[model samples]
Target chain A: MAEKLLNWDEVLIGGTIKDPGNSKQYETGSWRVERPVWNPDTCIQCMFCWVYCPDSAIKVDENGKMAGIDYTFCKGCGICVEQCPSKPKSLKMILESQAKGKTEEELRKEVFSSEK
Target chain B: MGKKVALTGNEAAAHAIRQINPDVIAAFPITPSTPIPQTVAQFIADGEMDTELVTVESEHSAMSACIGAAAAGGRVMTATSANGYALMWEMLYIASGMRLPIVMAVVARALSSPLNIHGDHSDIMGGRDTGWIQLISENSQEAYDNIIQAVKIAENKNVMTPALVAQDGFNTSHTIEIWELEEDKKVKEFIGEYQPLYPMLNTDEPVTHGAWAPPNWYFEHKMNQLRGLLDAKDVVEKVGKEFGDVFGRHYGLYETYKLDDAEYVIVAAGSVCGTTKDVIDTLRENGVKAGLLKIRLFRPFPYKELADTLQSAKAIAVLDRVSPAGAQGGPLFTEIRSALYDTQTRAPIVNYTYGLGGRDTQPRHINSVFETLKRIVETGKVEKQFDCLNLRGEWR
Candidate 1:
């Protein structure tokens, strides 16, 4: 998004995308109507949501542990939520309006802290 | 100079395609143009050319396959006519928009309604707005020469737009004429190699084609496309001159016969230009200062050059082989009128919609057009702004 928009002469001819993996700049997360909030308290790191996420939005750390979700590219399709196997469900989809104005830490604390 | 050989327009197109021997050709047979792919297939069978022929089920798939091959960085081509051309209408814009530099031969024919298949401009006229550079041929010789020139014009680094070389259906496609057929080696050397702009198959430096362009970028992309299309005028002239330099046949944006000092002139395209030329010759023998302006390039329509060439004529008539549909005048007519609108040419211009649905236009019909032009010049008025020629029933 920091890259300046190109003029007609400056752009590549034929609408060809010369920059590979440039979709990372597109921020498809803005299309989401609902946000998936993740809870580490549920304690199961089966990585089912990671395997099922169509957008590959599920973030994994160096030890291969599920860290959290990357919202920049997530379309909130909820496939990850559907794929969650934990009984208390470590992953849950909430209305974007419900999650708005709250950080991931705040939303996770509010949704999972009381259950714990 | 090339050797003289006899061929029909379709055969000439096929021979030119064989000479080019492109990397890929995807086509589905239709009337008039069916022989083009068929001849190319025969050439492949005989090993005369090593081009890959992708025989698709329909025109849509034919064009789709052509696009795929072209995007994959291969020199590509195809042929179709009438409804088959109508079928490929959607992909036409995509081919040009993507700047693929594909070439096609269209054996121009009439579109259907009462179900007729014969020579007419209805099909090519319908596609005038599709953004592909258009070349209309007067006979088998121009058909052969134009096809060879088209490859260079389309694949020019500056103008990577798809191009279509058109000749009249039964009139030119089926009729035989002697034309200069260049040696294959010379023809190949003339077209040279096609360097694709952004080939999708370059694995080392991969690229994505046909990506979705949102509002923010769509306008810029379209403007970029227009840049290429408009820039084609210079490339077309440059390539034409080069082709003439290499071979003996020279071409230009348009060809004019006795246009310099003529007071009454007729502007037209396609095989009809030949007949019009004969009529002009006869009028000249009778001491009438009549001439003809035959359009070779229909797209990127050399409006300024045309208006300049036609500025001195006292009266002008535009002969269009297609119906106006609902417009007040035919496509070529309106374009010519518009071109002269800003010029000092005060000539009274008129439109003639003729030869629709394969209706044969005789010399008498063309002679009548000139007579009308002469009358308009003599009387200082246009009796009919738009009229039909050689129609069986009176067209008011």
Candidate 2:
């Protein structure tokens, strides 16, 4: 994001679009201090995570099976972890600080082990 | 020609709504102010008025619907009381931030906590900084008149901000009073049809409202809003003059009674002003230089005008119907004292919270406040500053 200078009046009434579904541009994921990691192996096909995520972060396949979290807008609220309904939680929250410079595949295996 | 009629404050305000025949009225039932929307609903049911009444689930939705309707280029109105008004806290800012010309009738009631359903200033006083023009009425007639004028004030090209006409809860809401109501045709003519600057559906010209103002832009919008409110002061006076010219009743930001040469004074708002005036007459008969300052327009508060009026009095007792909780004084007292700081008035000011939860403040209570002012004038010092009037506590 490039920082641009704006005048006082322009700043006060900044970019308020009247159009609906404007939140797509907002990217609330920037507010997340924690990230969700999903273990698809132990994960049951039950879509409870999809049903309970406040932001609808848990993505599902066309057949209604669990896919993964949409981290762009997920906000990392952890509702999916709470509603997972598995003994050892299939979904978990990991510190965002540990997620830096790591690929999605690397972070999942690092913090959450399925063998437990 | 106007006809003399007997009506309660809420009933009279509903009559004003009928005359306006707004495009939308979104409201939920709440104590005291319930009658306002209730009567308006009855009118719509009876086919006396044609308004799309949105019977919302709660006060929050009521304001939310009003905002949508107003933003879509429709004249909008609503009414609520203590908790109902409290519920609309966030929406209130949105309505004003978008500069929607929505008019609301607020039957001022005490907020709940051990829950009492009577008149008090806690409701409207709590929303003082919500950026809506506030008009306080002493009786049914003023409530009727102010609602009609609020339409013009809120819709003024220079102002386009929402407004609320407030009256005491049961004290004014349910109490019957004789008032001369103007002809519907005349009232309708006074408040002309609303011409929305940019309606939402104006396809040729697109407009946006309720956008998030970032730090750079939010401060400017707030400053512009402040300028709009400050400009509303002029628009309020102009509309008041126009209403007086048509209806034969004049109003100003604040009304002063015998304040010119007053040695002792009392300042208050709403229905209590009527009682204070009666006490002032009696005090004057006995050679007490007591006067009363009744606040009518509370928002864009007439700081300069009020400070000028209180300058003549040697001492002033600011009567607040709502508790200050843990402040130096009540809300009104703090404003008055602060306004006088740079002014020529060096009079000792006292603060007293009175009439919480529909507790009746009679003329005697008002007379005692004047007496306290006189004593403070003689001794030149306040006695146990900031006390509650007529409370049952031994310390009081």
Candidate 3:
């Protein structure tokens, strides 16, 4: 007996069984993770996370301790998490939910208050 | 009688162009945007559109041809996406700088590598720094109408900068929708004929175009370009009002949905905003005080309007489709922050990254974003950054 072969064209275009993950299904650059988080316990202080972070979100303290990731500049790629060599992995990916909420009016007040 | 026609946003744009009856159509095919020129060519071949369809070798040449045709006092149009947009970068600046009223359809596509051709804001986001007037369309209908309005807005004596009407590729560009096609005579009356400021091909009025400016006068020439773009804000408002009066469809620089008495909001552009609106409606039904801010005009960014609209919210989530690799922020996020800098309106505006490289952004995901915004408003702390929605990990 011959084994059955799956036709990609039929699967993709025939619409019989649609792969939602199909590359042609959507436009490019639609899924972007913006920031990467770091954990001190799993960090070896190897600095790979700092070196690999495209946005330079990873910072090292004066004492050489891996300070913290700056959410402002981070694009959440989890590259630092992927690059961490520690056994438990010191770096992690944090979703956009981790930041604080500041209303535009609140921000404006802060700006004016600071200026005063 | 209004007849419904199922067409992709690109096809709808092509249909709209057919009604416009432009003298010249120059373009280079690029993913998600290729269908536009292809459909336009079909229209031309079928004699539906009496126009010179020039297929250029590159996106750069496409705009160059558009400039040439428009300068020669011909109504011109073109389309490009993603890397093609990046390639046309210098010309984008030149088109606006020269104050040539060229109308371009920019099918929003992601910038390259791990190269993808789906939909994303990277292309138009990259062009934001250019002086062109940018309009983001949420659906096929807006894509059709804005391209028509783009011609009017750009050609207006008060606003001579080229215009970029942007639509998400694959998402909006390829998605089928039933849309109403405006009457040709109505569109003609609405847009009017192209009247050239300086017809380069004219023998009677010999004049030099794109001439090199000496250092002594270079600043003045640049200043004129800046002044024209600044003047365009009023022109955009006026044209938008006129268009609405004629077509019964009105648009503002930015549109607010469900914002009345809302404590939290989500701001975004393109088709995703439609999803956000649905989510906002769901949230409202559930008694969540949430709203949506849809950004339509991206270039002149409508800074004052954005600051005012978002002022009352306790928290706002600013969603961007493009990630700035080295900047630690999405380009639009940065711009929004800067726009709010001096205003008395401050909202803890959280930056959410989603729908990059053509990722699916569903209504449920948008609902979750509003949920997150509500949580941020209540708790006073946000994770700062969040990926609104994403696909399950694939076994590659």
lDDT (tens digit, per residue) of candidate 2 on A33-76: 99889888788778898888888677888888889988888998
Q: Can you write out model 2's per-residue Cα lDDT over B1-396, one digit (the tens) per residue?
A: 898899999998999999999999999999989999989999999998999999999999999999999988899999999999999999998888888889999999999986988999999999999999999999999999999999999999888899999999988999999998889899999999899876787766666777766675677678778777888998989999999999999988888998899988889999999999999999899998888889988898989888989888899899999999888888999999999998987888999899999888888888888878878888878876788778888445
Worst 10-residue lDDT window, candidate 2 chain B? B211-220
- Between 1 and 2, whose lDDT is larger? 1
Q: How does each model score on TM-score?
A: 0.92, 0.83, 0.75
| C-alpha lDDT (0 to 100) for residue B217 of candidate 3 | 44
Every candidate's DockQ is 0.72, 0.21, 0.01
Output the better candidate (1/2) by TM-score. Answer: 1
Which regions of candidate 3 deviate over 4 angstroms?
A1-116, B385-388, B391-396
Best by lDDT: 1
Q: Tens digit of lDDT per residue, candidate 3, span B83-169?
A: 999999998877876778888899998888889999999889888878899999999999998998888988887677889899999
True-contact fraction in model 1 equals: 0.85
Ranking by DockQ: 1, 2, 3
DockQ of 2: 0.21
Displacement of residue B16 (Cα, Å) in model 2 is 0.7
